[model samples]
Target: MDQVALLQISSALLLNVGFIWLVGSWFARRWLGSSGVKRNDVEPALRKLDLVAAGVSAVASVVALYAATAVMGGISLQEAGPMFWMMLSTTHYGHIGCLTILAMMILFAIRVRGGTSGASDTASLLTIVAFAITRASMGHAGENGILSVSLAAEVVHFFSIGLWTGAVIVSAYFVLTPQRVATLALAVTDRYLNVMSRGVMLAVILIIGTGLYNAWHRIGTVEQLTRSSYGLTLLVKIALVACAIGLGGYNKFFGLPAAGRSARGVAVVRRVLQIESVLLLGALAAAAILTSQQPPTAI
Candidate 1:
């Protein structure tokens, strides 16, 4: 990949990882105090990753801003600042991306103050919505004549993706992260499994429904799916997404209960989580690739 593509994929990776850190840790707080665990008890674990959420968002602002200028506008990174200003004032995606970057920075500021109120979470959710708008404005969804439905679907899909990524991280942090607190880890993991599972299940449904809507609009037919590069890559992305969903299912239904029963099951759950996180990254990479590919109709 070139610098532009690398930056695009990096932006995706950072966005997902940071989204997971920001929201997963928030939800993890619920499990932190329950199951006979005190809020202060697990504060150390949470504290360690606390800086990550805001730090990454701070980075994302710069990356997303430069990325919009470079990838969409064909401007060099250095010269892109003035061009970015011109585009931001003149173009659609540029406007949304600037707003998204602003939202990101606002969330980052909240995080710096160690804020964790419902208000902060609400702000985070809204910022994520702006980020989704940035996404919708740049992709095939932005090209649609009937743009309202398409943009809405893209937003839904993006939100679901962010939610699922965070859900997976919630599971991964308790079960897979280093620092041995075996009994405590097991307790918290067991406590939050249901919430994580249900959230992920809902996200999967939204992702699928919105994804299908976009795919149908873009590709139009079965033959086009095989004949066109965009559709073919999309199929691969869908398969990878299915793999991620299947892994989550296996962990929730098969692995978590087993983990609760014995140490061996805990190890299995850890491995399952490792695989699942990797699969999610693969799916995201495929999505980044999908954005760059031309649909059959375009050809």
Candidate 2:
């Protein structure tokens, strides 16, 4: 694919990831919070958020599907369209299974907030496992061990993104809102900040480590980092990741301390989170470009 097309694909993938984060965070908060909202209240908000996420996901998925089809469709049509359908079938099921896990996580939050659940958390986890295996079947995991490692890294990265970002959003909302039914709000926020900070650190490490491994494996040489298409894409992604880390460092050292006392701290945290989100999106866009490029396999 051309650069423009590659960027488009990457942007779409980022959107997919972002939308999933949104669903797992903002949507979950609005629906599952212990804010005296009723079941009636819950359904409406959940439906609205789910609809938006679904729409965005569908668009991204269709574009990705079309692109994948464009490449594989011709070959499959000539050779074995049935096999193509079968692969798509498995992949589609995995997508659904992942989404279902997200939905269950939302419900889990609701139950944790003192609501009840007829669904099982174990089911959600199993679905995630199945989805992971299905995805592995498609990538380098199917062909080599390295792809599975990359996929595992991606899972950690994506889940951490969801947790840290979601916690940031939820804490900010709690702080800004006028409701004061619980004395534990501040305490909860503090504890959450600590947990999220730790999680974000782990995520940063995972992203960097796994990303480097994938790049080294694909590029295969020090010189290729600057000489190849994959290398250039890696450069852009690395820059974005560094910027994100800088913003995170600012939040951790300077901003988080003030986060408790002054409105300025809260504002700083919010702004930093937004910037981090943008950087994450940029990283994803670069990834999209990278996925479509020819790796320096022999070099």
Which predicted model would earn the best TM-score? 1
lDDT of 2 by residue, 110-133 (tens): 433442233433443343344334
Model 2 earns a TM-score of: 0.68
Best-matching candidate per lDDT: 1
- Model 1 residue 212 CA deviation in Å: 1.1
Off by over 4 Å in 2: 1-15, 18-47, 73-133, 145-188
Task: Report clash pairs, candidate 1.
Answer: none
| lDDT (Cα, tens digit) per residue for candidate 1, span 1-299 | 67776776677667656765655666566644554566665555664565666568657656766776776677666667667677677887666666666766776665566654668667756765676676566677877632588878987887788778766766675634545336465666566666567777888899989989988888989999998778788888888888888888898789888977766676787778778878887887787777656777667
